[model samples]
Target chain A: MKQSVYDLTQQHRSIRQFKDEPLSKETVQKLVEAGQMASTSSYVQAYSIIGVTDPDIKQALKEVSGQQHVVDNGYLFVYVIDYYRHSLINNETKGNMETSFESAEGLLVGTIDVALAAQNVALTAEDMGLGIVYLGSLRNDVERVGEILGLPEHVFPLFGMAVGVPSDDEQGSPKQRLPFEHVFHENQYNSDKTQQLEQIKQYDKEIQDYYQKRTNGKRSESWSEQIRKMMSKKTRPDILENLNVKGFMKK
Target chain B: MKQSVYDLTQQHRSIRQFKDEPLSKETVQKLVEAGQMASTSSYVQAYSIIGVTDPDIKQALKEVSGQQHVVDNGYLFVYVIDYYRHSLINNETKGNMETSFESAEGLLVGTIDVALAAQNVALTAEDMGLGIVYLGSLRNDVERVGEILGLPEHVFPLFGMAVGVPSDDEQGSPKQRLPFEHVFHENQYNSDKTQQLEQIKQYDKEIQDYYQKRTNGKRSESWSEQIRKMMSKKTRPDILENLNVKGFMKK
Candidate 1:
């Protein structure tokens, strides 16, 4: 019997290295169709998928992402929060829809819509025996991405996905997640700092052990250590300005 | 043979009414595990799931959502963008992680993380023969929701989900999405106004037909009409202020 989606999800690992087999147009269509079917907030469907096939365009995106896989994958899909279509409707009817899409709630709705659709695409591609990695690095420079993709106002490039068959060298297992008890709250949030700190300490140990075992003790960074190293300096301080340039979060 | 995730996604329709049977604790745990396995941005699992079982809490949340399913479902899950754990780590280590999580990029990362995980849970539940509907209505009163759920700083309720076995009367088909060509651009975004407006005109007709057929000719609102009606006025004007209050997007 085929494994259930839950089982499939448990096996998920971001695949960076991939075989050079490109997906067919039919497969791309199927993936997009699956993505389109994800639940949209109020049927707004405030997102679009850009299939980057032009090698030059992919190269441009790769430069923005600073990732080889952005250009090496079988397919590259950049998901954008798109309200340009709604804008068209607004213009034709002379309506005031900008009051909505220009608000912070609009940003949340668009972001949620794009992510949900992308996850569907991710899971579906995985089920089809493809490996995928998200390219948030696309946001490393939003203006350049917008220029590369020719995205219009009210359409913000949130992230990209590189999908293809995994290479033999790509053999990473799922990373350990936060314990269910720590992430799952019953009825109300347990803001008890002591309990939360205890859970994190245990998780930190597990992460350290996993890293040590994976790298023969060459690397043994705990989760907290890694997070501190990553988050100590702001990554992409220009995001707010970029969002404004893209005509998002302007309310 | 079991259905593929793509096939499963194609059949997705937001299910509101549900059977009386609640999910088992083991099942909930399995779903949460599946959610946790979704790829997070840089291993920043910046989200928490609140499983509301207490009738009073459910009723309180239902008041915020104004949705009966919030109280009537087999289970209710409120997905929050959580940076509280990271803040704790920052406090203990006296790290400058706030420079990252306080930025707009942090908001994007947290929102994307929560939505991706939520989608995993949605698909997993559907695969298990249960139904689910997202409750973006939870944002209708974020402050009230925070009070009800006892959410703390660095944690914001983004949305909720109501899950259960589908009731016999609960039968609805997936709504037609925008045209594949319209939503999926090749190489880059084609922001040509004429092309986009033409696509939207066609989609409007399809949506009109869909509603007319579904409601036995009682309703025939076009997609454009519905969007104009829903978005002409601002929704959740306080989202930005709320984000600031919750210690998000402060920079």
Candidate 2:
């Protein structure tokens, strides 16, 4: 309790590597329960946490995520946008199944609720001095990961988290962010192109300096260039079809 | 700092009623900055927060959210799934805005990022003795809100939040959740409907009891019945069309 929640949030950093340590079932259960305490949309609780403990599953998930942290961390939990349980509740009580839990509204509610719960789990783990990194790379081949995890329709795996003791005391430093004015808008959006570009340029300079110093001058790309490089690629080209077939989002 | 993050998370309750005291711009900015500290997918940081302060806009948003808290609270913020800023970077650097920033994967990343940031803000506010209530009803009329917020393409208003000093000290106790085993699965999903049904029945009974007591015999719906009642109605039926016309979730 030495650090306030605000301080822990501000000083947060992602951990890609970790030391070899095993988390007990009870310990993991405590973290997962902490997730359940989060706010849910309409109390639907449209989410699930799969604690991957089997060695085979961990190795497969590591390959799926393209991050060794998945296999090396003290614990790895996959957060899934779940409607199956709710569907079950409907089936039992109403006896009238929903034709689609795949509406855009459902997508927002389910995805947001899952994300909120996952953040709770992450913050709690961080409070315990555990290093945590979100494994969004788990979506590199989402269908494959879903199949391996036995995820049914309407239970898409959103992301994974790797939690463990830090291999080194160096979490480095908190990354720099854009200017406060540029990010937090007042009332209507400030879509003034010139003003935003001017602010982004200044923030880009800060990012460039941070990267140049942190990476020992090996990488000196500005924020704009970084965004360009990142966005140029076609990621998960079949995303719509996957979401449609997996019953994620509909009208 | 006496309370652990776990305690703070578990004690979380929706704050609908708030004191008339106004929040300083600096305090809200600090909370927003703490949001930026959360992990982003591939550094996309695909989220934008609109601080609603204009009186007209506030009144309009309060109606849109169907929650008076939006208008009476100390602060109101709408978290938008944003890639327009990223599109701007593409325009500045690559001069060729990639067409793929509107994919389902992108939507997931953006939505999750916004939710994570929002939960940080909520937790920070709660830790500081401020009340917080997420405004999911903002989506009740997505187009109207988008117009009100002057939101551009690639920025969908996912949700809003109200934060202020608690009007009353009685925050109430946390709600009960499903058994640990029902929500937290092992390496693979347990699709055993019989076992799940048994557990859910017990949970439904507990919820029925809680609601009955809280409402003084006015309401006694079990968890299953509650979810049924919620899902029976088609909410935001035009959500897909809304998102499509507003330029979101394209391949």
Q: How well does candidate 2 score on lDDT at residue B98?
A: 50
Which is the leading candidate under TM-score? 1
Q: Tell me the lDDT of model 2 at B82.
A: 79
Clashes of 2: 1
Share of reference contacts found in each model: 0.93, 0.66
DockQ of each: 0.92, 0.69
> For residues B113-145, could you state the per-residue lDDT of candidate 2 as single tens digits?
999999888888888888888899999898999
- Model 1 chain A weakest lDDT span, ten residues long: A242-251
Per-candidate TM-score, chain A: 0.99, 0.94
Write down the lDDT of every candidate, Cα atoms only. 0.95, 0.83
Across B139-179, the per-residue lDDT of candidate 1 in tens digits comes to: 99999999999999999999999999999999788888888
Give me candidate 1's TM-score against the actual structure: 0.99
lDDT by residue (A103-148, candidate 2, tens digit) is 8888888899999999999888998888889998888888888889
lDDT of 1 by residue, A1-251 (tens): 77899999999999999999999999999999999999999999999999999999999999998999999999999999999999988899899899899989999999999999999999999999999999999999999999999999999999999999999999778999999999999999999999899999999999999999999999999999999999999999999999999888888
* Residue pair clashes in candidate 2: A102-A250
